[model samples]
Target chain A: AQTVTQSQPEMSVQEAETVTLSCTYDTSENNYYLFWYKQPPSRQMILVIRQEAYKQQNATENRFSVNFQKAAKSFSLKISDSQLGDTAMYFCAFNMNRDDKIIFGKGTRLHILP
Target chain B: NAGVTQTPKFRILKIGQSMTLQCTQDMNHNYMYWYRQDPGMGLKLIYYSVGAGITDKGEVPNGYNVSRSTTEDFPLRLELAAPSQTSVYFCASRPRQGDYGYTFGSGTRLTVV
Candidate 1:
């Protein structure tokens, strides 16, 4: 079974600053996919960024980027030039290439202080 | 694209009551999933379907049933509602082959009293 863990339950970042949300997962498969999702107060889950296990370069989406360390089983999300809109519940997810199931972590409540 | 659509955005049910949470997707995706989100528990998979006529239980499938009779619809049924079942349910769909992220619905908030 694959399990994702987000150690930081709550995090806060000042506007225009940078913040990183930590995430770790346990998986035996070498080839898989990792994802970061954001859920605002509106309750819609949006994909922030994604990283492929075989890709060494981390994934970057505008102000959202990921630090994917496959060896450490760590996939952290970094928000650069953070804005108030970045405040939300962030989730880390894992999915194997061979399976249809995607496992999600508990989530990190992030607040962008203005 | 309409993506994934879940009906009855909000619902309240009494104990022992039964109801169905409807889900449909227009992307013609072959895979659909049902998940429940709690305050601190994140999202737990309740059921999943690879395609029409093929369904399987996920991490937490107790007290719930699902049927994927068509490619677009995957409905979840609750036989006897309980307080523990109170949570926000989300329906998601993804392509059968690819690394594309799943498209999630707005979610259905169900409160079991």
Candidate 2:
């Protein structure tokens, strides 16, 4: 079974500053996918970024980027130049090789301080 | 595209009551999933369907049942609700190809009293 773990319960970053949410997963399979999802107070879950296990280069999307360390089974999400809209509950997820099942970590409550 | 939509934004049901949460997608996606979210805990998959006639159980499907009669709709049924079943449910869909991320519905908040 694959399990994702987010150690940070809460994180805060000043506006325009950067913050990173830590995530780790346990998986024996080499082929997998890691994802970061954001849920605002509106309660909609949105995909932030995704990293393929085989890809060495981390995934980056605008202000959202990921630090994926396959050897350590660590995949962290970095938010650069944080904005008020970035304040939300961030979750880390893992999926194995086209598997329909995606396991999510507990979650990290992110607060973008203005 | 109303990608995915879940009906009954919020509901309160007494224990042992039965109700169905409706989900529909406009994306014509082949895969649809049902997940439950508890406070502080992330979403956990309850049931999923690969296509109209194919369904499967996920991490937590003991108390929930699902049916996929059409490609666009996948409804979840709670035969006899329990207090532990109180949680926010989300419906999501993903195309078999050409997309990586799953399109998720807003969610259905259900409380069992």
lDDT of each: 0.93, 0.91
Worst 10 residues of 2 chain B by lDDT: B94-103
Listed per prediction, chain B TM-scores read 0.97, 0.96
Pairs with steric clashes in candidate 2: none
**Over the stretch B4-113, how does candidate 2's per-residue lDDT look in tens digits?**
99999999999999999999998889999999999777888999998999999998999899999999999999989999999999999988622266789999999999
| DockQ values, each candidate | 0.68, 0.52
Per-candidate TM vs. native?
0.97, 0.94
Task: Rate residue B91 of model 1 by lDDT.
Answer: 96
- Model 2 chain A: ten consecutive residues of lowest lDDT: A95-104
**lDDT (Cα, tens digit) per residue for candidate 2, span A1-114:** 788999999988899999999999998988888889999999899999988888999999999999999999999999999999999999998888767767789999999998
Model 1: per-residue Cα lDDT over B1-113, one tens digit each: 78899999999999999999999999999999999998666998999999999999998999999999999999999999999999999999998734778999999999999
Off by over 4 Å in 1: none
RMSD of each: 1.0, 1.7
